[model samples]
Target: MRTIQPIPFRLLLSAVLLAPCALPAQPRGPVGSVRGTVYDSLTRKPIVDAVIEVQATAQITYSDAQGRFTLDSVPLGVQQLTFSSATLDSLGLYGFAREVDVTSDTRGVLLTTPSFGTMYGRLCATAGSPSRDSAIVFGTVYDAASRTPLSKAQVSLRWLQSSEGGKELSNPERTTATGDDGVYGICGLPADVALTTTAQHDAIVSGAFNTVVGPSRMLRRDFYISRELGQAADVRTNATPSSGSGIVRGTVRYERGKALPGALVSLIAGNRSTETDAEGQFRLTGVPLGTQELNVQQIGRGGVSRAIDVTARDDGTHDFVLRGTTVLATMNVRGKVGADQAGFLRRKQDGMVRVVEREEILKRSDIGSALKRLPGLRVAQKLGGTVIEATRPMCVGQVPIVIDGALIPNPRNTTTFSVPQALSGTTAIPRATTTPAPSRAAQSSVVSAANNARVDQLMVNDVLAIEFHPGPASVPMEYWPGPPPQCGLLLIWTVASNWDK
Candidate 1:
């Protein structure tokens, strides 16, 4: 509107060209939000007062008492979130590091912080004294079938020790390769601690050992690796298959015809053991073909044994009849089933319980898979991961999931939409009847499921045992101190001992 614009053509052109740069900048685009909860993998409990931070960003928040956290204004795209709490770290638990995609608003992000347990053992030659201390744990890995020492095998030791203040401390976890002599060892371990030892070789099944270290005691532990049937067959294509391996299937029952679950069945020579299922059934694979002695023992029951001639690839059934009598004075079953108050067998007897021990859990990759095999339980895949649901029709409230004596919050549906129901009448008018409000039972179920932890986050190898109760009536009194689940309960114990399995 001013006459200055017409002062000169050069000035006018320059002003027009510089208009954009001189103007104020436009506001940035809207940012997204991230919200979730952190849980203990072993205990399945929410971690309160935990700090959650997004990497490379200023966004941070601490979890509330419910273990819930929200990070607002998080830049959209993939972001790595970390969770930490001093209380958890003091108990030998580490923080969770997870990468999440945040294209928009996000929810139901579950992170699990795993705790550490100890295992200790010594490695030895087939006919030699405990290998030297340096080589005690690191011994030549061998193929169980071929009995040939395997070189370049990997050995690992993982454990957590206690500090002077009675706080748990985690080790850096040691791993090493087998030497030319097939010997290996892990150094710098705390004395008198429990640890988990594993040995892995090419094409061979890995071996896992659980034991505790005694003061200055050299505990000899050996690895006998075996390939699966298909793998072993392929490796021996040019040679005859070994005749020393086969499978054994059997059942354990009381003389009164009642099935005895949790019976420990072991092959005396093979050192392989397994527990019976709910139906008192047991299957032991890879038993050496020959005259083998089978020992079967159960808590509060007398031990029994039988001699059997196992044939290569044989599949047959052998049943044991255990008589209920006074605990055998010299049975020595206490060694297998520990006297600890938290022992799997002891807790199982407290209620109608089904247990999955450490050995069975290690055979699977994740706890979900191991749980899927249980009877009367439905393991389904949801948006996040596998979840367990009670298959019994009469169940009501959400099934409670407990780990290491900690109750995990259940997942929940946020919406309140209700489906229309059909009503029959001989009238011309169409009724506009609103849906009925949810019953108190239904409301409780929603709340329970909403607060439960995600079960898929739990690792199978880290679990010591699992207990499943099909209904509230079967849940143990100890697990019912709070609001009891109307449907059922699932309890998981992860603070493992050397006696587990």
Candidate 2:
């Protein structure tokens, strides 16, 4: 979990600001006292505890609570001044320098970081004004083993704004890819709210980074990820398991060192499955590297699941302490979680909820075809992707999609795919074509590629259950916020998690 620190980024940037801006010389001066204030140029927050020093001299001082600093009897005629701090370094606010002229007792001197307004000019759209109201989050993604920056890695940040009534309101999520420098920046985030972040490169993922971003211009967050084992990959996959995967290993033990032999373990994402050995040890190889929900169950006992960050190096063993429960009459041969089953049955009792069982789900090939089979539902094409819509006369907007326990957010400002469609289909977005394909295979591949880009489809085999609420009245009161998401809701319980509501 260590990171490569003191990245020299600040040193280089500071050097640029210190050199050759052509400061004209002032009148004759002598040794005198100098006073100054330091604050973050972006957020305008006074940065206390910063070390301010006169370069090439022993006179060094630290900024007080008000970011004020003073030096007495300094030989300060056009002297170089530098200011820095550990907080500034951690926040990416360092790398600024100033030269002060001291003819007599100097006052009103100021130092600050570069303006974020000029730095991120019109980079992203914002729900509010791009300036002041919205903020930016940028950071580097590094490879843990190499201690080097990783490019093309994905970093995501999401936050929510809820009403006083506890009805879920706006939940916006944004994601971006790291550049060649292994740095990624997401702009236009709402300020003054708590946000959660995660990074992923191929199958390797980082643990969550949570922070309450103030109404600042920017914030920096970094991630470190280790590559998966070269030889040990997903054993459950039919095709050759790629080297870019990690093993999810753990032990299922009862209290007092009792190993629970024959206990079943599975990834909620499905396909990968295994059981504990005589020692109550279980290893699930080749879990697609990222954050995934894992479910564990045993007969005559309960079940438990946790969202795990799958990576090459994870001691992420699930150690549950579940007391025995009544035997499940419908325990599957594969050791399905009793909680998952009971929860599904309980949800079926609701008149407003429409549940699709596994058998019917397995029969369908794609989400579009599967959803259309249900009553009061239909599929429509939008933004070059498929959208699930409620067929009710009064409720005619796109249905909000929820996968597992998370809601897929659709922001008004996103330039890329609307992530709510992230579950609508399983295919990529279609690319622009100059002409129709002459061969059937080529046409099929092209069509699939388009579907993939759309992020609006999913293969039916990956789905275990589907719940549809045709209107706000149909949605359970617990999840509904009074007025928003009026179109209805679609909940997909994938093989990836036993989470049900």
Candidate 3:
């Protein structure tokens, strides 16, 4: 039986071929890899948490602390890589993009994008009527040692704007933050969009987190950004590593013979200026060391100009007086009324004068609210809301308003000048006169209230009557220093009828 088996050559051949098929095919090696680093151009530091995406495959990879990233298993080909960072972007870096080449079989490539440095600044306005969505966020983030672009740093933004009618509005303008690479930008603003851009340094603290402003500091500054009535624009933010700067300190005053309260003071060295407080005092800080032209003006009164030479250690103090020429009239009130001599009292409390009440000062749409209702008088917030001046104006400092007979300290910090004096009660309404100035007994009571921080500067409950003193239409010889500057006439109000009447 063993000898009967016959071997077939065909079967033997088939067995050999089948044996080869049983062997396993080796797994294909990875196609290729894409690699890159997100870094600041200036510092050469890596950017972490930056999102890098492959445009073709829509695959994404986040950069690590060293700003290094790799996309594995990428098919061999040209790939577009997109980079994006946080929206609340930092001062240094923004976003970037580039095309990368990938070879087949485990080959990886690297990409370097542009770095962005950043700057910081603020926004301000001339008048009380505020502008909206006004500000610029621009700057370049750079390396501390090489002064190169530092594309990966965080930056934040906060802002405030003035309100219309000198009244506080509920919401101030707010904006979303932005990110960066070698360059950064965030712009889309309204007429009020003038801002001070500040840059935060990674290793350099002096120029870092400091504000960058206009033409005077142009060598180390980017540009002056202003928002026209209706347009979208951006202002540049540029800053250097130096910190030595000059400052201007002083108070603003009316040329007319008296103190000006609530008069705004604007200081302009180069496109930058801030308003003073009710006392007419102001400070222009961090001014680049140089010669600067300073223009001081009472919004509605009259503006005056001066030139100042600034130095690194300079804390220059200068005062100014604006003139009033033209005057506003009684016709501007909501309900047009003629001039009236009778003083009005607030309906709430009998003893308290209406004008002395905070309600009287704040309730109306403009400064002339209560005054307009009275006969023969009108009021307006003019000087484009910069100055709370009146027409048929009184002499400089001629109008005085006293809270409790004595002047109230200006809320803003400055000593050069006190607030504009309110008109005297007796002068405003001949029939109604102010109560006598506080005697020693009254002073003692005031002291007690002040100690408890309960002193009533503008207590709503204690008001009695308000008096408006009408000034002459023309400037008098006494009101001028030499020759009266041309200006509009303004009326003044004196508070002091009787809060406790």
Candidate 4:
């Protein structure tokens, strides 16, 4: 270097060309990393075996059982992180896309996933008999694009009954994992009603929905899933003659003023009948549009018939009032229990219990008003709608509103229902009326109701009975399925009649 002659042009160019291959690769400028844990937004529990991938990079990793993931050698700049898992997708839980910065080694990043809407379909071998005892709903999960059945796919089946007064039913029986055949099934399902199925596979897009186990004795419904995130599969089913139908809504009441719960409201010419709810409300869906005959009957009050004009859209409300005494002559109380007797026995059996009958519910326009009649329960207005609170204070998540046997999840917490401010009377407020602050319990119920909006979906006329237990100690074993609520429990039972023909 001290006295060397100048290098020739060709040799200098050659050295310059080889320079990039030498010099220790410039030390890579301190490669960065990213780490985080994935969690279920609803359950707030860590997800296990979830996968994490870096966009625009070869770095990818799977989450440990604790839902923890780590990626090293990430480029030092803004980077997008994607998460996925099969277990989560089957339950309708979907991961969120996150934009993360990798300027340095990052840690403790929390990613939450929300549940996607469910889809519904039916599986049957033939169209003649849709109901089969011990019938199996089996299907294969395949790559949407590749058309290959996925292995280790998770298929879950849940009952799709309406929550008595809560959110949609989420009663899972068991989870079936696909094997090398990529096939799964749930047997011994009740053939009387439809069932819901969900599918999930690692890094594969999943879907959930209620499925109609059609009459086909050995029908199969296959699901093709995609790798794209945040998308739910659309529900598909065979069309029926009554596919394009409408709904009929209304209330049945005693002539005096009381709403009639438990009254048999049937379509005269059709094989469809349902009992009125605690609010004396009733809804008949899948009703063919046009003129329909309605028949209302109660054991003691007798029966009445009327004609209703229905349309394909915009549900119509009808009110019926019977001209008879509310009291039924004391009979042996045989056969099915009468609506009035059901309400009376519920009250007579327990002094602490507060019963909301159809008659009372029908009197009120909203569920909040119907609940206000319960002792020690207060209803207050909020930004969304009226919230129910217990006069006796309780801890967090103590009071759970149960419909039928399923607990109603708070609508606010679920994506299923959206509480319209309009329904809660929170949209337009009058300056003259000053609303008081809601109690903690009341605020919680309101939020729960708003979040779940199950109460709002309940037509007073569809409720058969409602029972309020002030606290855990008061809840009956029959009504309390899982753990007892810490605060109190609201029980709602809907009318389920065997009128389907």
Per-prediction backbone clash count: 23, 25, 89, 42
Worst 10 residues of 2 by lDDT: 229-238
TM-score of each: 0.31, 0.43, 0.27, 0.27
Give lDDT tens digits, candidate 2, residues 221-330.
Answer: 77765434211222222344334356788888775668888766765332356888998888877555544445565644545555455554665666655345433355
State the displacement of the C-alpha of residue 296, model 1, in Å, after optimal TM-score superposition.
Answer: 7.5
Candidates 1 and 4 compared by lDDT, better number: 1
Better of 2 and 4 by TM-score: 2
Lowest lDDT 10-residue stretch of candidate 3: 226-235
Residue ranges of candidate 1 with Cα displaced over 4 Å: 1-138, 162-171, 229-244, 247-501
Q: Kindly list the per-residue Cα lDDT of model 4 for residues 399-441, writing each as its tens digit.
A: 4665654444453221122223322312121222223445557
lDDT of each: 0.53, 0.58, 0.37, 0.53
Q: Which stretches of candidate 2 lie over 4 Å from their true place?
A: 1-29, 122-129, 161-171, 228-501
lDDT of 3 by residue, 207-307 (tens): 11113222211112222111110011111112221322456778766666455555433322233456667676777665543333455544245445554
Is candidate 1 or 3 superior in TM-score? Answer: 1
Q: What stretches of model 4 exceed 4 Å from their correct place?
A: 1-132, 160-172, 229-357, 360-501
How far residue 460's Cα lies from its native spot in candidate 3, in Å, is 3.5
In TM-score terms, which candidate is top? 2
lDDT, residue 259, model 4: 85
